[model samples]
Target chain A: MSAPAALQVTRADVCCVAAAEAWRGDGEIFASPMGVIPTIGARLARATFEPDLLLSDGEATFVTGTWAVGTPPVGAAEAGIAYRTVFDIAWAGKRHVMMGPVQIDRYGNANISAIGDFFRPTRQLLGVRGAPGNTVNHPTSYWLPRHTRRSFVAAVDVVCGVGYDRAAAAGPSARRFLELRRVVTNLAVLDFATPDHRMRLASVHPGVTVEEVVENTGFELVVEGEVPETPVPVEEKLRLIRVLDPHGARFREVPA
Target chain B: MQVADKRMTAEQVVAELRSGMTIGIGGWGSRRKPMALVRAILRSDLRDLTVVSYGGPDVGLLCAAGKLKRLVYGFVSLDSIPLEPHFQAARQAGTLEVSEWDEGMLQWGLYAAGLRLPFLPTRAGLGSDVMRVNPDLRTVASPYPDGEEVLAVPALHLDAALVHLNRADAAGNAQFLGPDLYFDDLYCMAAERAYVSCERIVSTEELASAGLPTQRVPRWMVHGVVKAPNGAHFTSCAPDYERDEGFQREYVAAAKDPDLWAAFVADYLGGDEEYYQKAVARRPVEVAE
Candidate 1:
């Protein structure tokens, strides 16, 4: 098929492409994206380059083809893998979930559980739902529509998802399957690919400067020689994203 | 010989539960919980109990009522509302002892208990703060040449297990017609005494005809079955009814203030299950924004 005409790419579109890149090499595994933009990205990935990746209907069954975010799956009955089987797949390290963290540190330690002291938290978020298991079991990425100092903290309040330092310290079992893949935020795509596994600014989104990303981050990011702009989705990808998210939910998540 | 009938009322089931007992509640976040049984616990004088769950309103209600002395959970969240208000308040207030595990670790713990094992080795909690906060958790070194060490998630043995399903028989054979069973069977197997509350009590033949045989929780694993239609109210009992999001919003709003909470308790939770159901039916439906 001929590629569709190139259109004006929004930040949300760039974010979707960036998020989908997280699962580019994740062959045959479950692409469990938590929110709208990520969900669109996962669907886009499956529709395009990563066709083998499994996508759950966000409830019980594995689904193919895309539906609008927040709508029910049309034909989930055919691929009915129950919650039990999902757990089994997760434990066996065959899933890559993109979670949203309330706070993330330089080492990639994330917190979704609480804000302050564990004994008496100032604010309690969703208690480490599957962060601990997800991080240690398989490739775990994160998506943040809004990136700020509060989210990019120097040290997280509670380490729900294990980072490089903690994984190294925890020994081989922790390190074996641990893969903190990417942190796709509104501003940039970041990863812990440094020599010491410190979060490095991989690419600044179009119109967003490296200074802006560094300024918003709570801790020092390993900014290398030259940072590239996050790639815009091509005609085909943008068309697929529109098809997957017909209601413009990704735009609602990240805004135009 | 006649088949033994293992039917009981919510109150009767609660009567079987002693104070300070560890109870495992089935269902993930706000879905298909044994909320009728949970409401029964609320009406009773049960206090200082240790509650285990992939919690939702069950944890919130228990926390609001000062029922939990300790809580072992993966997370306490109302799916629509990210954080459960009462659970958050209780945690911030330091009102209850909390043992938070990774969601998978919680499952493994229950699975180990179901298998009557002391602990199950897993890599889930290894590098995360779950180990830091819950210092009592131990690690087991692999006996093989690799000697890989993994967190030994201890068995979450319960005094009782409570689960809500779509249908069941009087002899306590339960079946979930929903797409996901959400570890209900494992919860039942892990507990000493297990009670099931279902939306309908069908005949054995009807129960067998309802869903896949794998979905059925055999009578041997269940100690009692309580038939309470809409038993998992406020939570989604898919193929039955969706989560009462409007009611849940009111519940969350009430949790923010003591006066509102008291009024909510009196208006909704004050009565018996029948009254509660009627109160729910009588309330004006809320239009989603």
Candidate 2:
């Protein structure tokens, strides 16, 4: 018989690992991840390092065990929190939601709402759903499967999620629990860790260059020195990812 | 003493609603919406309405029909289809006024209305463009030593509220057998008048025994109960049915072109609710080749 093949890591796997790292230190908080890869990442995080992280089945239940992406939660209903309770938990600053925005700026300002004027937008998207409250109340992060100049803009059309500069300007109340943790993209991972609170190039994914990231981004990113490659998932983590996404829905999101 | 029955037809409920009324609609996104009542309103001569909703096809239908003057909402999305096409078209054309609040802020506004409070202080919209977009919103400083300032989100007082549920009794005690209540009770409590349409009208004893007691929308808040089977069509009512994704796809497709939209309206929305239901039943099921 032929020997077992070596575990091959894909771009989607790297993105999942990077996305999971957003909730590395967040403990016992509700992890509301939107989209496929983010959901997979949140599940992986809960399955391994962050065991205390509460995960919802995207409808209205808190799921316990790990299940594959797109499958129904088998036994999560009995101990589920209703929609009203979800609002309460979010308001109490006990949740970290990773969202997918249409446009995001260097300052961490995101817009899932309309594009163009407030009154009459050229393209109307989902009106600021919970982005405003989520950013101002608790920790928030973002995941972009496709990192292009269009998404990583100089300025967002509408500020649904508050950035560091705007939070600072709003004073003590807005800054009370506001934390924009991380932004993971297909090309690289970014964070607002700079002194000026601008978006910094945290790390580039394997085979992706810092210059390539810069070229893709519309604004000037805070690239200090040599950017390290995003760490590949360990064997166990890769297995967990596979287990969490058996049908490979993550591949559909980030492609091969 | 006998208990009064608050049962009413969809048309009767729509007849009570006046033009330019601020109405709050229950259900989140595309799930469990009161589409039957919405269609009734569509059939009526109602115009210049200010609607408050989590928004799904109800908002899109109203926008397409030119019934809304203003819309106060957190978001309007079809869950699967991210941006609602008709809402997009209306906004792009500058046809309606909008007060876009944070989802939590909208909840707070409704809660404040239910409590009969002028406004409630919340940290949401403190630093975002929500303040800029909604210039009427004000910030209040804390009375204590910290002197912290927060946004005092004004109450979204509704003249009327419309919601859908899984079951209800004649006296208007509603129950949602679905996973989430989705703030439908809050929508009822926040309004001056509220109407609930359900998939089935069960007895009070059956309603009480069928679901958890906590899931019931008490009769005291609801003014009218309507028996509307498959009421939340296109949107999901769960247990009863899931979102009609095929129909919704047709809806989204129709919204793209004027000719297709006209054809859709002729085919689907030409007559009463019964006609619409019949048309929906007669649709050819898509079979993958």
Candidate 3:
């Protein structure tokens, strides 16, 4: 038998696949290109970054950091309209949010804020800042970047925003919404089983082991009998990003 | 019984308009605003109107369709949908005078105005340029002369409050069933007269049985309540009903192409109010699955 060629893959390569697929190559900034979400903000320009909705499944709380609120980070500056319009260019609504806490429940519910009570209690986190509305409103999705059981639990401590179950329950008006569009990670592609609430196995990222995904999940998800591997970013997505942020604001790991 | 076709007619409602009036609109970032009524106001030749919106297509259409002079908003929002080009062009051309505040601040401002309070103190305008734009809204000099942040957004008083609801009783009691407990209440309370459009008009008894009557608008404050079906189409979906997905997709796609957008407006808005229905009649429903 011919010896298997030496494996060629790294975390960086895997990360890009995780993100690019979530965006489905539609994050067109200028309607230009790259179309990558803000998470992989480094893969884009560094001007003004307004992440869609923080998508962490690991942590349900917020950390006090310069990037959380205050001034814009380094990379987000470029997305602003060239000249003047209304507010500054920092978060002109282009976004790829981060969510902490690794395990996400079947309903796409997350727990990042606190483990117990919110006020003067056990764990305190980024107090529900725009989570409820953000998830319901814009192009919202979640990300573990790194997945784990601690992140995905039976249910979140609190359902800060509408997830798949709630979105469907809300009405047809909100049907095309929070419906957990995508959940990206270091391993695979996850989608819902039906128009209902079951989180189903969509596909695996190239080189990720089925065991890795199983180990990371908190609740029981509908596993696929045969899962295909996710594809990497095509030349079109890369070329598109280059045009949207010619200044290279999003691609680099800079502060914005 | 619920009022069947209980309306003063389009001309009748339009005739009630006066100069230098304030209007309350029901919508959020364009999802549920009354674009048709707004266009009607534009065609009426009304001017110097102070328009209030929680943020919706109403703001842009009013400004772009060439009707508004001044605007009060918390944020004229947009989602996957882009900012209305008419509003963008107007803002660029400096024809529309726009004012903004935080969503909560805007609601409370209207609330205070409704409650007849001069203003309400809030923490929303902090750390944002809204304080600078509407400096008159911010405050200074606490009791101890130490620095304490406070702002008093002006109380909004409107000549008319126009809202679209899911259900209403002919007696003018309207009910809102969305999570957006926005300034609709405050707007209606602050206005001198109120007009409501609803997807369905149910009998007072049915409304009472539904247990939503408590939230209904009393006849005393309501000037007119019209049973306008599909009223929120292309703008916002009726809760629990179908969404205007095709229109939304078409709007975003058209907005991507200005030439296409211009042609779209010419074909649709150029026609009568029913123009939208006929244009969308042949359009296939997206997100149908």
Candidate 4:
């Protein structure tokens, strides 16, 4: 793609661009991203390429414009989203969530539940908030600030979100609406477009080597010849991201 | 004739709790939890209780008091503060069993119980570790052969539900001046009894005038009401008050040491709601980071 004149981009900026790319072509959908990085990405997507993406004020109402980080919307919202209405949107599959889990496997089975056994977890993390319904009902992508052997485990200790294998075993009804899309990490952008539904290394971020990604991942990854570097965000998108997140909290998640 | 006043002290309402009974506490995280009722439970000798909640300081206080034998919850977080330290210590020590569910599934269970259904079929726990941790949780096959299997979240019937609202009448009608009701009404209906603690006791007419939109819980659903000022302290009650961040930091920091935690709990846990409030007022507020 041709550059939009005058753009300076960092690796972390590239990662946000990749995260925003996950929701590309998604016209008019609830783009709910959990953590700081994904929140910036969702806002970035709404402000630029995916103007149709809907955002909430992180409280009770929806906002047409991207909100500055650490601040609620100052103007009127597009509409109100109550506790009951949020569930209605999710059950209808009108939502696309970018979740962050503690562990993820080759098949995209993620875990945010606990580290040890189910009965007695040594290190307990957040329980499955909405991962199960989000995965089965609509398209779900993952964003990990740090990617390592521990996070990209051979197998998750607990399966908080159903993977392709588990979804298939659960039957065709389970697989129909299931779309396990991009897995955006600090190191690389991976997806399950392979024949076996394994996570394929889509692109290595700038200055990151394919060898380093392979060394850090616990399970085998699908790496085809000549892995491409993730595309850099144009000047317009970069400027928009800075506005959406004036506090630079996104940098804390994936520092350049 | 004046409506029978259901007003009682927190100690009196908490006395209704028996050993080995299941209870549900309302609020999400550290927001609007019935800390006064929780403190009352701590003061009592209640033991082996099964507590179901979204969880906040209430769970931590109960856990620290050794009152819970089991905790059925989606998560146990303190909002601005991450995990509740006392809950973590209790879990690590294997003192109590836990049935972890998705946040939606827990809500569905309560909804089903409130509606008097055997179970609610939901997609929330279908592929999560919630089922694995809660092995007794079952799934039912869809009637249609092509239909996907859905997890059946059983009804979470409770002996009592303890909640704190911004205002209430002597007759038990409650109003939440906050932005969100946090499913306090569903919890109230899902229980055999619901005891509410409010920041102030207004007349029935005044509660009605607060407007229908703000009336979260109706009179019929509430069995008892306690006038506990600063009832949901240290937790945000919205329009009424914001979270006591400095005190929360102190609570979290104190839990690290047994002697310190014991001393902290002793200072904050006993006495009625007013006594607790005055005690809090006396402490020096730390500067926010």
TM-score of chain B, candidate 4? 0.96
lDDT tens digits by residue: candidate 4, A1-256: 9855675677778888899888998889899887887888888887777888888877667887667777877656788776666777887888898999989999999997778876767976766666777788888999988999999999999888879987877666557678898999999999999998999999999889999999999999999999998988877888987887777788888886
**Candidate 1, after superposition: displacement of residue A13 in Å?**
1.1
Query: Listing every candidate in turn, what is its Cα RMSD in Å to the true structure after a full C-alpha superposition?
Result: 2.1, 1.5, 18.5, 2.6
TM-score of chain A of each: 0.94, 0.96, 0.60, 0.94
Candidate 1 Cα misplacement greater than 4 A, ranges: A1-6, A75-78, B211-215, B287-289
lDDT order of candidates, best first? Answer: 2, 1, 4, 3
Model 3 over residues A156-191: C-alpha lDDT tens digits?
664554466655554433343343556666567677
Q: Local distance difference test, per candidate?
A: 0.90, 0.92, 0.55, 0.86
Tell me which residue pairs clash in candidate 1. none
Who is ahead in lDDT, 1 or 3?
1
Error of 1 at B211 (Å): 4.4
Model 3 lDDT per residue over B24-98, tens place: 886566555655566567567788788887656677667756678777765454544534545555555557676
User: Which numbered prediction scores highest in DockQ against the true structure?
Assistant: 2
Q: Give the TM-score of candidate 2.
A: 0.97
For residue B205, give model 3's deviation from the true position in Å. 1.2
Worst 10 residues of 3 chain A by lDDT: A82-91
**Could you give me the TM-score of model 1 versus the true structure?**
0.97
Report the TM-score of candidate 3, chain A only: 0.60
- Residues B138-174, candidate 2, lDDT per residue (tens digit)? 9999999987999998998999999999999899989
Candidate 1 lDDT over B167-257, as tens digits, reads 8889988998887888999999999999999998889888767656635688989999998998899999989999999999899999999
TM-score for chain B in model 3: 0.85
